[model samples]
Target: MSNEMIKCTNVSFKYIKDSEGDKKEKYAVKDVNLEVKNGEFLVILGHNGSGKSTMAKHMNALVIPTEGTVVVDGLDTKEPKNVWDIRSKAGMVFQNPDNQLVATIVEEDVAFGPENLGVEPSQIRVRVDESLEKVGMSKYKRHAPHLLSGGQKQRVAIAGILAIQPECIIFDEPTAMLDPIGRKEVLKTIKELNKKHGITIILITHYMDEAAQADRIIVMDGGSVKMEGTPKEIFPRVEHMKKIGLDVPQVTELAYELKKAGIDINEKILNVDEMVNELCQLK
Candidate 1:
C-alpha cells in the first residue's frame, strides 16, 4: 500500500495552440515530482500561471499527465476505470464560491454531490446535516445561498465536498475572493477539519499568512518546486524567497528586516504573538 494519497512522478504538461495556422506548445507544468501524504496539511504556493491548479486537476484525473503518472490512493489517474474512485477520494474546492454552488438552498447544494453518486436518500440526508454542522452552516440549512456572505457560501461549498466523504480536500485559493472576516472563517473551519477530523488538507494559495499555518509548504516557480520545508525553515531564506517574488508572513518579514538592520532578532517569527514573546525574551 502506498503511504501517499497523491503522487506525481516525473510528470509534465504543455498547452498546444494553433497561432495563425502554426502549432505551438507551451510547457505549463514540467517534470513535477511531488507527493501528498495521508492526513497531512500541505500548502502549495505559487505565482499566477505557475501550474499549481494544473497539478491539482491531475490528482482527480481531471487532466492526465502528458509524460509520467498521478496516483491517488495507489490508484493511477491515467487509468480510465479509476476516475470516479479517484475523484471521490480526493475532492476539490475551487476559488469561486458562486461557480461551485449548484442549488438555491444551502443544504440542497450540499446534498447534490452525494445524490449524484447514488447514495441512499436517508444516508444523504444524514451526511448533509453532518457536513453542514461540521462547517457551522446548519443554522442556515434552508437559507438561499446567494443571500449568504462570501464566507458562508464557501463553507456551504465545502460542506458539499464533505457530504461526499472525501479523505483528502484540495482547496485552490478558496479564500482569495473573500474579505478578511470571510478568510478567517474559512481558515478556522479548515484548520478544525484537519486537526479534529484528521482529513488530509491540501491548500493552494498565494497568501503568505495562509501558507504559514501549514505543517509543510511547497513553493513553486516555473511549475517546479523551488522550496519545500516547514514554515520556520522556509521563511528564514528571505533573499531566496524575495528573488522568487514571494513574501513571508508579515511578522516574519518584519523580523527579517530587524535582523538585517542589526537588531539581533530571530528571522523566523511568524505571528505578532510570537514576535511579542521573542521581544520579551530579549529584554
Candidate 2:
C-alpha cells in the first residue's frame, strides 16, 4: 500500500550543445525511474555533476524531461497548461537563501507566492503566519529579511514555499550555504515538516549525514540510479560508495573500521549511538 506522490517513468534529459555537430547532447539523466510516496522523506545523493540537481528541477517543472515523463500528484509536468499548477504542487527551495528572498520584510516575502497565485489578502496573512510558525520563524515575521541569520534566512525561504500550501517540497542542496548551526536549524525544520506535518520531502544533498536522516536514499552516478535503499542498507557498503566518489557517514565508517580490527559489530551503522551500542556488545 503506497500513496504515490511523485512518479518518474523512463525519464531522460539531454542538453543539446550542438544541433548538427558530432557531440550527442549532454545527458543529465537517463532512464531514471523513481517513486516517492506521500509523506515520505526521500534523499537524493550524488557528487557534483552527477545529475542530482537536474532531477530536482524536474519535480517542479523548472526543467521538463526530454524523454519520458515526470508526474507530480497526477499532473504531468510537461503539459503547458499544467505548468503553474505543477510548480505550486511541488514548491522548491534552492541552495542559496539570499536569492530566494525577494521582499525586504520576512512576512512580505513569505506572502509572495500566494500573492502571485491571486490568493486573497486575508487568507495570505493566515498562510504566512502559519508557515512562519511551522519553520519556527513566527517571531521573525516582522523583522527585516537581510537582518536574519543564514539559518533564519533559509527558514524564511522555506516559509515562503510552505506559504503556498504545496503538497511536496524539493530541496536542492538547501543547506549548503549555511554554517553548521545554520545547517542544523534548516535540517530540523525540514525534519519536523516531514514527521509532524506529513509534508513530503525530496532532499538533494551531498552530505551523507544529512542523507542518513532520510527515510530512503537514492544514489546517482552518471545520471542514473546506482543504488537505492535505506541509510542502513546503503552506508554499509563503503567500498561501493567510495568507488562512486561519495563518502559514508562517519559513524558508519567507524563501525566498519572496528569490524575490520576484529571487533564483533554489524557493519551498517547510521549514528554514533548505534556504534557505541555495538561496541558495548563486543565479545
Candidate 3:
C-alpha cells in the first residue's frame, strides 16, 4: 500500500463570473502541485481569498480542478465514479459547526454520516459512541446540539466526521468562527485525532499557533503556493511572511523583535517554553 494519501498535480481552479455581457474567469488556485502522506499532519496557511480552502475542497471532491487532477487515497477525485469514495475516505469539517450538524441530538448528528454510508444499525451505534467519546462529548450525547456551547457543538460536528471512520480529514478554517475557548477545544480534538488516532490531517487555518502544531506547513498567496516547510523553517522568515500578509507565531515574532534589539535569542523560537529555555541559557 502507498503511503501517499492525497496528491494534486498541477492543479488550477478558476471561478467564472458573468460580466455586463460576457463571462470572466478569476483564478482561485493556480498550477499548484502537492502531496499529503498518510497520517501526516499538514497545515495550509493563507490570507482570505488565497485559495487554501479551494485546494482543501479538491481533496474531498467538492470541487474539481479546472486544469489539473486531484487524487485521494488511490481514487481520482476528478472521476465522477470515485467522488463518493474519495469523500468517504477524506471527510471535511467546515467553519461553521451549525452548518455541519444534521440532527437535533448530539448522538444522532454523530451517527448521521455512518447511517448515510449504510453502516449496520448496530455498528452505527458503536461508531456514534466511540466517536463522541474520542471528542470528549460522550456526556452530552443526548443534549440538543443547538443548545450546546460553540466549542461543544464543534466537537459534535467533528464526531460526526469521525463516525465515518475516514483515513484523512480536511479542516477548512474550522476555528474561524470560534471563540478562543472554542478554538482551543477544536484544536485539541484535531491534534488528538492526528496524534492518537494516526489520521491524516490537512488543516487550513490562518492561526499561526495552529499552524505551528503541524508537521509541515504550506503558505499560500495570490492563488499559488509561496512557501512550504516545517514550522521551524517557515515561522523564522518573519519579514517574508508579513510581506505575504501572514503572521508568524506570537513567540516567533517576539524572538524576531528581540533579535533586532541585539538580544542573543533564536528567532526560530516558536513557543514560550523555547523562549524561556533560550533566555535561561543567557543568564
> Which RMSD values do the candidates have, in order?
1.0, 1.7, 0.9
For candidate 2, lDDT tens digit of each residue in 16-101? 77666666678999999999999999999999989999999999899999998998999899999999998888999999999999
**Better by lDDT, candidate 2 or 1:** 2
Model 3, 62-144: lDDT tens per residue? 99999999989999887899987888899999999899998888999998999899999999999999999999999999999
Query: Candidate 1, residue 158: CA error in Å?
Result: 0.2
Each model's TM-score, in the order given? 0.98, 0.97, 0.98
Q: After superposition, how far is residue 47 of candidate 3 from its true place, in Å?
A: 0.2
Off by over 4 Å in 1: none
Report lDDT (CA) for all predictions: 0.92, 0.94, 0.94
What number of clashing residue pairs does each candidate have, in the order they appear?
Answer: 0, 0, 0
Q: Name the 10 consecutive residues with the lowest summed lDDT in model 1.
A: 1-10
* Ten residues in sequence with the least summed lDDT for candidate 3: 262-271
Error of 1 at 169 (Å): 0.6
Worst 10 residues of 2 by lDDT: 16-25
Name the regions of candidate 2 deviating beyond 4 angstroms. Answer: 18-24
